[model samples]
Structures are given as C-alpha cells and as structure tokens.
Target: MRSLIVSCNVTVDGFMAGLGNDLASLDFIVPDSEQENALAARFREVADTIVFGRQTFLDMEAYWTKVDSDMAAWINATPKVVLSTDSGADVSIWNNTTLAAGDGAERVRRLKASEGGGLVMFGGVQTIRSMIAADLVDEYWLKISPVAVGQGSSMFADLPERRSLTLRGAKGYPSGMLDVTYAK
Candidate 1:
C-alpha cells in the first residue's frame, strides 16, 4: 500500500499560515542551502503523486505555472489529485491534474490501495484537518520555522482526539528551520 504524507511548512507556534492568510512569513524561513535543495529533490523523487485541496490546487496552479525551478517542473510533471466538492471549478489549466469529490477518506483509501509510488498532501488547513480526523495520514513531514505567527491557521486544529506520533527523523538547517518526520 502507498503511504499518504502530509508535507507542509509551519511556524514555531504550530501555525501553517500567518495572519490574514499571508504566506510571506514563510519566505524567510525556507532553507536556501544546497543541502536543502537536495533534500527537496529527494522528497519529490519519492512521491509520484501530489494531492491538494480545491483552494490549494487553484492557488498553486496559478503561481507555480509561471515559476521556473526544478521543483516547479517536478510538480507540473507529477500527477495531481485535487479533493474538492465544487464540480463547477475548472482544473484544466494545469496538465496531469484530476479532481476527486465525494468521500475524502474513501477516495484516499482507494488511492492507497492502487499500485503507485507514495502520495504527498500539501496545503489548505481544513483539508489536512479532515484527513487527520479521518485517520488517513500515514506520515507527517513538517518544516518548523523559527518565527512564531501569533495568529494563523493551525494544522492540528479540530482533531477528533489525541493522536500519538513516533518521531522518525529530524534535520536542522543553519537557518534554524527543522525538518521533522513523524509516523503514526
């Protein structure tokens, strides 16, 4: 079975997005070293599919489509599955992207049962929360930033109950960003 990984950047206070849903704060926290680039490459290498919520998919498609980078190329080339309820939204702007609406957990379970490489989920707090509530996330790769955004969206909010995690590994960069991996 394929693993579903939650990969995201979070603040020291455990918030994913800053106040006003601003993501500029994260620009300062992203590691710029060659090692960090290599690590990102490895991450993309392992996941054959990229999963996103409806809003995230649209946002990413709008921004990444114009960016020029190795990661952008990888993201564009890899298959994308957007979990959404809005059937009227158009997702044809990006190549290799598909929409899956209905039971989120069941759809993810079916994807896990399929023959493919690992899957990575990145973006939109509510979607991640739903996945966590459904107990469908297999692994978490959180890049904890140094600064704390006093108020913002949290990745662990509204969880049905406490969930224990085993620390698989952690890597800290010179920028004070820690890449931590946890397994359920």
Candidate 2:
C-alpha cells in the first residue's frame, strides 16, 4: 500500500492558522525560494497524488496557480484529489486535479491500497484530522513553527483512540522551524 502522509505547518502553540484564519504571521515559507523550490521538486518526484480539502482547493487555486514560477505551476498542476461536498464548482486549477466528493477516509484508504505513487495528504486541518481519526494515515511530516498562537485553528484533533507513531527523523531549520517525520 502507498503510504499516506499528512504534511502540515503548525505553530508551537499548536495552531495551524490564526483564530481568524490568518497564517501570514508564521513567516517561514518563502514560496519562490530555494527551499520551496527543492521541496516542490521532490514532492513531484515522489508523491503520486496530493490529498486536499475544500478550503485547500480554494486557497491553492487562488495562490499557487498564479505563482510566478514553473515550480509553482507544477505544484498547482500536480494530481490533487480533493475531498469536497461542493461537486458543483469550478475546479479546473490543473489537468490532474479532481474532486472526490465523499467518505474522505474510506476513499483515501482505497487510494492508499491501490497501485500508484506515494500519497501525500496536505493538511487542510479538518480533512487531515478526519483521516487521522479513522487511523488511515501512515505517516506524518509536521513542520513546527517557533512562534506560539494563544488559540487558533489546530493541525491535529483529539481522536477517539490514541494512535501510535515513531519519530523517524527530525531537523531544526534556520527559520526556527522544526521538521519532524513520524511513521506508524
């Protein structure tokens, strides 16, 4: 089965974005920089599909689609399997992108078990959390920001049972971010 990895950037205080949905304060990612460039290159090289959420679909199309580089467009154009209820919207952000409208966890499990490239589930919080709760996620690539958000939208939610994970690797970035990789 292909590994299901949930990759997200969260603050030290456990917030994924601010209370009002503002994420600009966590200023670590530079879109067109060497870091983002290399990340995108590797993401394309490894991940077969990108799991996204409704909000992610909107945000990505709004930002990444209009980005100033091919890497950005590549990121935008890559296969995105979004979990959305709105099956009647404009989702033609890229050729491979598609909306897979129901049973997020079950659908994801089927995708992971099927033959394909590595599966990467981008953290659109709610959707990712749902997968986590369903015990469908195989790995987690979490980027922990240095700053603290008193209270805001969190990356992970409390599931019914405690899921197990082992830290496979950890790296401290120059921008005060800690990149941690965990495997189940």
Candidate 3:
C-alpha cells in the first residue's frame, strides 16, 4: 500500500487560510525563508506522485509551470491526480496530470492501495477535509508558522471526530516555523 501524506503551511492559530479563504491575506502568510524552501525540497524527495484538488491543480499549474526553480521542475515532471467534481476539467495544460471525478474519498482510498511512492497532497481545503473525514491520511507534514489568524478556514474544521496522531519528528527553524511530522 502507498502512503498518503498531507503537507500544509498553517498559522499558529491552526488556520490554513485567512479571511475569504485567502492564504495571501495580511501577514498571515508564512514568509519565504531558506529553511522553509529546504523543508519543501525535503518533502518533494519523498513523494513521486502529487495529489491535488482541482482548484489547487489549476493554481499550481498556472504558477509553477512558468517558474524556473527546482520545485517547478519537480512539479512539472511529477505525476498528478486532481480530484474534482467538474468532469470537463482540462488537466492537459500540465504534464502527467489526470482528473478524477466522483467519490473523492474512494478514489483516494484506491490510490492508497496502489503500488507507488508516497502520495502527497498540497491543498484546496475541501479535498483535504474529505480525506481527513475519511481518515485516509497516513502522515501529516505541517509547517506551522508563527502567526495567528483569529478566524479562517481550517483543514480539520469538518472532522467527524477527534483523531489522534503520534508526533514522529519535529524541527524548529530560525524563522519561527515549526516543521513537524505526525503519523497515524
């Protein structure tokens, strides 16, 4: 079976996005630091497949494809699966991308059962919520920045019940970002 991992940059207050579901709102966004970039590179090393929600897929395709960075290269070359309700979603704009519509949780479950390297998810809120609700996540790699947004959307907001996770590793960077990993 494959491992499904979620990588999120969250505020200290536990919000994934600020007002109006904007991650760029105010100083709520984590500052781009070398340590953070290094951490992301580490995450990229573990996952050969990237799982995304439709909006995130489009957003990333628009931005990453035009950039000239190692992350951009990895994203363009990696295989991606976007979960969306829109059957007409055009995934051809990006390389090695596929669209999976209907039963998000089941599709994720099926992916988890497939033979592959780690499956890592970036975001799109709704998709993360569904995966959390279905308990399909095997590991969570969270970079909790030192910022507090009093209110916003949370990945854990709609969880049906409390789920406990074991802290597998943690590292504190000078940028005040806590790079932590939790496993079920």
Each candidate's clash count = 0, 0, 0
Residue 27 Cα positional deviation in candidate 2, in Å, after optimal superposition: 6.0
User: Residue by residue across 112-152, what tens digits does model 2's lDDT show?
Assistant: 88998888877577787788888888888777767775787
Residue-level error in angstroms, candidate 1, position 112: 1.1
Model 3 shows how many backbone clashes? 0
lDDT of 2 at 150: 78
lDDT values, one for every candidate: 0.82, 0.73, 0.83
Candidate 3 segments whose C-alpha is farther than 4 A from its true place = 24-27
lDDT of 1 by residue, 67-162 (tens): 777767878899999888776667788999888887767788889899999999986788888888888899998888888767887888787678
Please give, for residues 34-79, the per-residue lDDT of candidate 3 as tens digits: 6556765875778888999988888878889898776677778889
The TM-score of predicted model 1 comes to 0.89
Q: Where does candidate 2 have its weakest 10-residue lDDT segment? A: 26-35
Candidate 1 stretches greater than 4 Å from native: 19-36
lDDT comparison, 2 vs 3, better candidate: 3
Among all windows of 10 consecutive residues in model 1, the one with the lowest summed lDDT is 27-36
Off by over 4 Å in 2: 20-34, 69-73
How does model 2 score by TM-score? Answer: 0.84
